[model samples]
Target: MKVLVKLIFLLTMTTPAFAQADFKTEQLKFDRVSAAYEEKWNSLQEALRSAGIGRPFKLYMAAYKAEGKLELWLKTNGQKTHQLFRTYNFCAQSGILGPKVKEGDLQTPEGYYYLNVFNPKSSFHLSLGISYPNQVDRFRSGKEKPGGEIYIHGNCVTVGCIPLTDDKIREVYVLAVEAKNAGQDQIPVHIFPFKMTAGNLNTYLKQFPAHRAFWTNLQTGYAYFEKNHMIPVLSEKSGRYLFK
Candidate 1:
């Protein structure tokens, strides 16, 4: 009877992930990109595997080009939370952050969006789409089209989308799906500058002087999130962020 109980316990512990998502659609993405991103992905996997969040935690990045660099981070637990994880070069040919107001502008949009789906039929390999033309962007641009097609995809090349390389996106895509499956909804993405760490600020200060105001705004949001471990409802009072 004791032996039989041990066998059943082992089977239960080693049961297959039959109910978990099949991220086959995102394979072969994210082989490489920023070392920091890779490291974070591994750590996240280990954490989930250990915590057994009973599901994967969704990941999100708010990519921004400040001082000629592209940076990203991870957000989890639905759209209710976020955390700073890594930074990298813009790697975009066009140059800079903010919406691509017009074609060939070479700028990645800045603001709140969500990773809604994984696109296997992507020109840049696998792609995680951004819900662009968000209300804020719409009001900011005041343009009906304001263009779309933003993504965090494979292939380290960009016109208007982010390139995380085929290998890298594959990895990122899997992580993202895990995060969504874990969180139970679309992942919230808040694209912003390097979040202005003392070091980050000093590093890009020269290249992105115009971005100081933006980065400063992010500092407030970053500080609040860092303290609360939850994404605060940002309220604007005379162009200032007041946690709601």
Candidate 2:
């Protein structure tokens, strides 16, 4: 009987439901995180339900620098494509419309990345760190430091990070937590210098000719998402991004 009980306990511990619950349990231990749950979870869940998106959904975030917009996309119930869930405006903007190259360049990076860090006890209320200086960024930087530590955070202030107001961050942070707890790891966060419409691209290219090559490369990924409303499969080669 003791062996039987131990076997059941081990099985329970390894279940996906158990793992998901453990993730939320760890996050709620933080005071700010707890407060955010208290404030935003109910509404967030209700919004999801209203939109026909059920629990354990996948999340994708996209940020456009020129527009100061952050869009949240959701895919759930084994859906093939993502739907636009919400759009939030950045409370602050930093630098110009270009890819960040070296350290202290004061430019927000433009590329594909995923959320790799969650800071519940963040000094900026709450923050989700993006995987920057990716292979392509590294290749471009060469011998220089490509700069790092980019995040979508709160406090409405930034040098190179995307900042939403505290109230707004609460909503975003809670949604991210729920998605993570639902077993959707590697949440994607794509940043762009601007909406890559052909007109905009041509206009910006003339104004900032130096970034034409880089921006054109970025437009390929942008066009894919615009057409399919789906995440593009990306790979890096020779300091350039190739979208599949």
Instruction: Please provide, for model 1 over 45-91, each residue's C-alpha lDDT reduced to its tens digit, 9 standing for 90 to 100.
Output: 67555644424344546565555343334543344554544444444
Candidate 2, which segments miss by more than 4 Å at Cα? Answer: 1-17
**TM agreement with the true structure for every prediction:** 0.62, 0.93
RMSD of each: 8.4, 1.9
Model 1 residue 166 lDDT score: 66
lDDT of each: 0.59, 0.90
Q: Which stretches of candidate 1 lie over 4 Å from their true place?
A: 1-54, 67-93, 97-99, 197-219, 234-243
Q: TM-score: which candidate is best? A: 2
